[model samples]
Target: MKSSNVFYLVYTLSLLLGLLCVIFVITWSKGYRGGFAWDGSAKMFNWHPVCMVTGLVVIYGNAILVYRLPFTWSSSKLILKLVHATLNLGALSLAVIGLLAAFGFHNKMHIPNLYSMHSWVGFIAVILFGLQWLLGFLCFLLPCTPLWLRAAYRDVHVFFGLCILAMTVASCLSGINEKLIFVLNAPNSTASYKKLPPEAYLANILGVLLLCFSLTIAWMLLKREWQRPNLHASALSDATEPLLTED
Candidate 1:
């Protein structure tokens, strides 16, 4: 198979596999009233480790595609377009699957705090990413369109892309720290419930901090874009008689 197909297939399959892993992890965590211990609770379940490792791998693998997209083939239009589409669609799928895991699908399963935050934030980030992808696709697909509209679309796309990237980082860190899992079960933790380690608390704070940073960066980019002019601005300026007049 061609490189593109390989990339697409691996990326797509990773997404599906990651979805399954997420589902299984959520299901496994339901047994723990407080925070589930990897050694005591998760090790007993075959799916937990599989889900955690595979889901994580899938997320990282997808990031590889994201990284490759802009820099790898700066001169190749066709390849760039294909990679971009794959990342956008694949990210969307992961986001949806994550949401299902968090929302307690079928009412039989629910991931605790860490997983829940991971899911919700992931979904929001994906929503922002989808908007970014939609606007980008429109800008590229509609080259004959008005310059002003194209510029506006591109600006929106750039700003949202940055947002998605930030959210992606937060989601990944939350997943790694396993704090999101702890947060979900926080309300139920008591004398009868198992207490989480100090590490989880730190992770939760980090998650919040990461989210704040992401939002702050996104706002900064949006402000910058709003103040900047599009390529058409130069074109419009060039068309005026003042610049064209032969001194």
Candidate 2:
């Protein structure tokens, strides 16, 4: 099958899975005893945990698959280009689910301290991810011609990839606590909230740490590039060397 077709198929399946999971969770929250809490008051569905685990695996796995596509020449081979495209689309779908589930649990658990910050970060991450996905899809349709145009797309693609990587790292750091406690429907409370252990402090700490690291990395890379008078030809020859020699 064509990459596009495969992409649609996989994306559709993942979407359906997410929708079903959401429906199940919503129903459980509404009808089950105490609602989305870890006090053993609510009845958790058997499939919820399984589905979530599967989804996480798919999400991160797809990320690796997408970023290493053959179209890049350096990492991907022509024969596997279709697979790469499908995986890229699949990865985007998984990212959306990851964002949704992260927020949904946060709200359900009523993690007071992390609520607002998580909302904003999740929103921003989703927006950036959407842009990245669109640009990637466009690259699929656009012909690899007109040297300058192709170069522009390549640059844009790389920018989005870096953005995705950074945002994901940030989001993951922000959800570490939730992953450990809420993921298994484990039982505890934070501040005024009741049920589910209060681990926002840990997640927040991790988030800050990751933010500092990301900013520092960006600063160092930018500083090095800016120090160079001209980033042309021989100046970047070594940088382009690996890309040029890759088969």
Candidate 3:
């Protein structure tokens, strides 16, 4: 298949995956009274998953693709860089809120934090994301930085961006499984995950959607046709211009 066709196909699927994630979260929230709150209840804890998926997974994925859009081909590189940074900042803000909600709920209940691999990996991914965003802003957005430095860091930025996305997705799946296990084993809950309840199916669907979203974003980033063209005269002037431009 043509690269354009594959790109659009994956893009459409990624959108569908995002929609499914929202629906699954809303359905679960409604079923369990898991609405957002600052009261440190289960509802407040619900905000963690919802925000993480929406911000870290969905919005972040789209932010990485902004430069790949055909309509942006003629747009100023500076504008695109700003848009990219702005979107990432938005994602980081949402993710921070999500983490706060989780920690607040746990602390209120006297639950231990960062005891699980999921939490450890998720935290690492968030930290790395923050550092990536900071470096990108300093090296690429700031006029004080030499063009050579920005060019040199472009590949590293892209590489780590994709790595962070993958890590987030994997951590999300692990978290879903962990939550399900806890809920199923709780004394008040009558249904067992062994029985494959509706919630179980919803969790499974959400995980699949997360995976699809990540895969689609990765494919789009890796596809040669979807990459942004280097139109800057300065970029072309470099004898050793990096093969990959910033997203």
Candidate 4:
């Protein structure tokens, strides 16, 4: 397929998945608790899913794709890099707030924290994400850093960024399953997998949509034509060429 066609297809799927995620979370929250709060109650827990879907999934996915945007090709590389870093910082901030909400709610309810597989993996992913962002800034964005170091770590940065995305998606899927099971097995509950409730279906669809979103982003990143081209010469020079610009 042509790169433009692939980009459009993936972009459309990303939008659909993002919309589905928001819709499902809002619907689920309203049907269960009517609205969200942060008062150490179950209502406060609503922020968990909402923030995760909005920040970690939607915004984070787009941050990774910012440079691949065709319109950005004409922009200065520094401007694109700044935009990318800013979006990631926003995502990290939201994810941190979501984590705090979850932990606060659990503590108030006398529920243990970090006991489940979802928590374990999610915690690790967040930690890795923070480190990745910090190192990326220091190595790539800082004016004092040597150009060779940035060049050396560029591939490493890309690798870890994709790894974090995969981990986040997996953690989200596990979290959805865990929540559904907990709700269905609660006292006097009528919902079950065999006779699934509307919420159950919504959760299932959300998971599928998230998976599709992640896959599309991954495909877009891997496509050669969709990757960002090196439009300017590096700040450091080899034996044959003169340095033209600093990133």
Give me the displacement of residue 181 in model 1, in angstroms.
5.8
- Whole-model lDDT, model 1: 0.46
lDDT of each residue in 89-188, candidate 1, tens digit only: 6655655544444344313333343336756676576667667667666654444545566545655655556556766766656664553454445666
Per-residue C-alpha lDDT of model 2 across residues 133-170, encoded as one tens digit per residue = 66655543334434344445765665665676566555
Query: What TM-score, over all chains together, does every model reach?
Result: 0.44, 0.43, 0.90, 0.90
Model 4, residue 165: C-alpha shift (Å): 0.4
* Pick by lDDT: 1 or 3, better one: 3
Q: Per-candidate RMSD vs. true structure?
A: 12.2, 12.8, 3.5, 3.1
lDDT of each: 0.46, 0.43, 0.83, 0.82
For residue 107, give model 2's deviation from the true position in Å. 7.7
Segments of candidate 3 deviating more than 4 angstroms: 1-6, 230-247
- Top-down lDDT ranking: 3, 4, 1, 2
Q: Which ten residues in a row have the lowest lDDT in candidate 2?
A: 39-48
Q: What are the clashing pairs of model 2?
A: 70-76, 188-196
Q: Which runs in model 1 stand beyond 4 Å of their true positions?
A: 1-74, 109-120, 142-145, 175-247
Please give the range of 10 consecutive residues that has the lowest summed lDDT in model 3.
238-247
* lDDT, model 3: 0.83
- TM match of model 1 to true structure: 0.44
